[model samples]
Target: MKKFLIHIPLLVLSTTFTFISCTSSKNVDTNLPKDIAERPADEDSQKYEQAQLDKLKASIESESSREKCANASEWTFAPMGAKACGGPQQYIAFPKKMETTLLPRIEEYTQKVKAFNEKYNIVSDCMMIMPPTSVKCINGKAQLITAEQ
Candidate 1:
């Protein structure tokens, strides 16, 4: 009877641990977007492109600061590494009525960046950094939602 009581507690403890381990092992999938899985694998290329992006962003910030446009929003492209760098990234939005006045300048700046990348042969296989055409604003910041087809 004494031996049975001691074994009962041990059995309960082992059963509890087994149940906890089994339940914890089943992780829920968040179901992220397909584009996230398709990012560039080349670390060197990603770094080079990110530098070009930073320069373009600086130009845009200088230009925007002068205009002081209210509620001005733009779609910005970011490589996986750029998100880790702390600074304002340049975003180019298309010709929407809300941002019509800024479109021409943005377009010119984007073209310059494109030219620089071409001159230096800094390119990426990933579509996100290769000139994304569509974006969605999340948490008051533009996120690349789609790549150019």
Candidate 2:
């Protein structure tokens, strides 16, 4: 019974110590003294922060430009089945508006592409070209010629 009582006090002390050790204290300046030195902002840190802000602004501008491109009444040409050359080429607008919406315009273009593919006796040397409103299938591929040259 004596040993148990002694151990109980020791256990309480250890628990109190553990609690004290685990408790996080924030060092806050409650009493502001006039003579306390105000820490100056580092020049390098300021420059880094400004650079990050500039990058963020640039990114925002880029995103806005892309949104404008996507929403604009512009036509995009794609080759029928050419893996590299047959995707959304560029923003082209016809003299007349195709439709009021983007989806219909894309669908119309897709049909045209399918027809072009069937009509043209295309080989690996075929190139899709954009001259404003129409997609032209040229005889030779630009990439192949460039590589050869």
lDDT of each: 0.51, 0.41
Per-residue lDDT of candidate 1, residues 21-97 (tens digit): 99887875546446954654564565666576677666655543443223325433332222112221234443244
TM-score for each of the candidates: 0.30, 0.22
Candidate 1: Cα lDDT at 2:
98
For candidate 2, lDDT tens digit of each residue in 1-149?
A: 99999999999999998887766433546565555355444654544444544454344334323332322224332222221235433343321233344335444544544444444533333355433434222332111112223
**Total clashes in model 1, counting residue pairs 3 or more apart in sequence or in different chains:** 0
Report residue 134 deviation for candidate 2 (angstroms): 7.1
lDDT of 1: 0.51
Stretches of candidate 1 above 4 Å error? 1-56, 59-98, 128-149
Write down the TM-score for model 1. 0.30
RMSD of each: 15.8, 19.2
Instruction: Identify the candidate with maximal TM-score.
Output: 1
